[model samples]
Target chain A: MNEPPRLGDLVFTPEEVQKRVKEVGRCISGDYVGKKPVLVVILRGAVYFAVDLTRELSIPFDIDFMSLSPFRPGLQRVEIEMDVDIPLAGKDVLIIEDIIDTGLTVNFLVRTLEKRFPRGIRVCSFLSCPARRIAEVHVHYFCFEIPDVYVVGYGLDFQGYFRNLTGVYTLYDPTGRSTQILKAMGKGGKR
Target chain B: MGDFSIITISREVESLGDEIALRLAKKLAFEIIDREGWVALLREWNTELPVEPPLEEKEQEEWMVTVRTFLREKAEKRGFILLGRGGQRILEGLDSAFHILVVAPIEIRIQRIAEKYNQDRATASRILAEQDMQRERFLMRNFGIDWKNPLYYNLVLNTSFYHIEEAYTLIIEAMRRATNKVPSVPVKQRSLFEEKNFLKERVFFSHPSEEDFARILDFYGIRWLYEPRTFPLVWDEEGNVVEAFAPDFYLPDFDLFIELTTQKQKLTWKKNKKVRRLKELYPDVKIKIIYARDYEHIVRKFGGRK
Candidate 1:
């Protein structure tokens, strides 16, 4: 039997992640001091980041969750599996995402939410991957900017595994390309 | 229309050609293979190839073959309306397929574009020019023929003078006439205008900033409706008087309305106040204001400006 893909190297330690999340949370609180904002957490991957970041918010805010069907070949449209129960009209909306890569999904989300007539809408992601962006979506707030690399852990997964892991890690690359890239970024080499 | 199962429509931008094709499709109960349909077909056939038609000559040749084969197979099963993508040339000699060329006077096309995009005549003219050049070049490069040459098409339609319903009825009548004709005889090509009379003019845009914004949206394949809807902000005591706000663009895919303001922050207060009032009145309507600085950032990020 083939062995499962191994966790390669630590990209962000638990402490680093928590610290950045807290800082981002503080910034959000400061910026939205007087207004009540809606933190729309993208389901599955972003749940961990949303929970951690929301806990650090000093101001009052409402939380909602949404999930989108994964892109499949031959499927002409992306379907919204779970929609937020809150009425978004006349409310400030801050979409919480684990990663903004390719910008397609977030762009779709923003467009979808825009139809709801939110007072204002913005994106706040845990990680921003500009290198992989195919759709141009503005990330108003982000904790960290990451390079184009396959990363897992901290709610990110590798074939449904590694969500339980506390820190972000590089997925074990047998070809060593990812390991080399991560190491150069001063991340990997921990295992 | 003698046992014809395929109708290929080639149209200039803002010619209402697509609208005519759609109406014909519904009336005839035929599948319409337009850009979106073609993309879907391409995706299903070859998952690796990009959905947009390839630009390289050799690659385009291969792409054309794939498309032609797909169309042939599809026609075998049921009738369909093939819109543009050099369909006229792709199935030129096919017995069951009839080709159409839809055109309009440059001024009329530009006027239509201006109204559709909520832009001024000059801006509309510029857009029309850009789109015409692109279409001309695409046909020239792919099919190696002047698409405007009426000889390639069995019927040439001038939508400038005809309404969409009228055009649709004309096509259906033509098809009925074709059905009565001898199957072995070649249908004579009809030219609505002489070659010299085929004057190509451009479309409209309201502002240079808006034009750039539209280009970015087009580049990303985002569908947008220009000034599609207006919301009432104020009403008189008798409910007869009114104040209203029309957003600049509505993106159907995103369900968002975007209003681009290139004015300075202080100058934008009026627009902002209108937007706030609009939100209060139409709580279900989602709108966003793209201020000058924000617009510049977006343009910079997307390299929208030339």
Candidate 2:
């Protein structure tokens, strides 16, 4: 008989995030040197990460965004309820996102994009918190691995008001509320 | 609870518009004023009426003649929550009744059709489209107006996303607001014939009851031409003409004025002002009546006021 292990503490400060983005950018540049990769960023939440991630890659790229509002708060669903379409058929596609927490929203995006039949599909997320990651999701590249604490900021919003923040920061408020915020923000979490 | 009694649901479809309607006969209150029943009634009305029924009973005859006298009598005495037949227009003069239009978005309606008939979404969409066409045709033929226009209805509800129970709650609320119940007109049944005829004139007739006003001229054998008050006038306190029910119905033959009253409620000061304004705008036509209960009978039956 064995007891399940408790989540241990982990941290990746602001500087560490920039260094990871540079590395991710290098890998993206090397991978798609001559090809045009269409980057589809989901709106309201992923604006910041998509911008930073695209900045790192030095290849010819076209950018588009899809906005959805299914799991706004107090709900858990495995579908992106609403989205504006992006041209994806026969073209190589890259879905750049902010974070992958519960992975439901991301999974829906993957399934939906698969239906459209892109030439190739890949996901690049800025942060990955695997302890909370749900099954059936694959993020091809990610920035840093950190212990699961609900974090916000860096274009990620808390109630859509805080996305203006330039960099990521942890909640100094109730950890439970932070978790609630995470579950809420987890709507568009990684994939 | 009773269907025949023109049941006003206290809850929504989720709470059981269908369930209540289906259960009504067993519950034995009245006939279910549901879709099939409503369609049957409409079909029967369509069977009796000419392609387009007249506004006044006089304007309609032969096939166009409806349960005219009965509509007058039952309107004052009946208790049914008249579903979708333009029945509201027929019973417009009555003050104690509740006239409501139950509406849902295309998605919810599509979903319900799919679930009810156990058909595919596309099939359901097609069916809904057909029903909508049938309804539009019926309204055009019967009321001489567009059914989707909210002005003709006492209440316009968005039932698409609402829980059936929430929808029912709204209907119940309408019953209350209607207690102040702006003395609404009864609903009439719509048919397809009026639709084709209206198209000949190049007018979009959406309300079933409104068809009465439009076909008034043709039915009466009167050479007068009338147009629906497609655009309503926004008015002031006094009954002075200041706005528009604009581009009034043009009746070049009779040199008479005719106004369309979708329902039978008294012309409010605001509405009166608009009507007066319209009258002033077109002085060529001299008549100044709602034709709420006139001229139509003559067109249908070639007779006097019903």
lDDT of each: 0.75, 0.52
Q: Write the per-residue lDDT of candidate 2 for residues B202-264, one digit (tens) a residue.
A: 665555444544443333223333353333233333222234454334342223344455444
Superposed by TM-score, candidate 1 places the C-alpha of residue B117 at a distance from the truth, in angstroms, of 32
How many clashing pairs does model 2 include?
74
Off by over 4 Å in 1: A73-75, B1-306
> For model 2, how does the per-residue alpha-carbon lDDT over A26-47 read when each residue is reduced to its tens digit?
9998999999988888765677
Each candidate: how many clashes? Answer: 12, 74
Two-chain complex of model 1, DockQ on C-alpha atoms against the true structure:
0.02
List the lowest-lDDT window of 10 residues for candidate 2 chain B. B297-306
Second chain TM-score, each model: 0.55, 0.45
Per-residue lDDT of model 1, residues A1-191, tens digit only: 86877888788899999999999999999999999999999988899999899899999999999997664433345678899999999999999998886576788798789879999999999988786554569999998898766677777776677877889887776768677777788777874
Tell me how candidate 2 scores on lDDT: 0.52
DockQ of candidate 2?
0.00
For lDDT, the strongest prediction is: 1
Q: How would you encode candidate 1's per-residue C-alpha lDDT over B240-291 as one tens digit per residue?
A: 2257777887654445678889998789989999999877755655677877
Query: What is candidate 2's CA lDDT for residue B164?
Result: 50
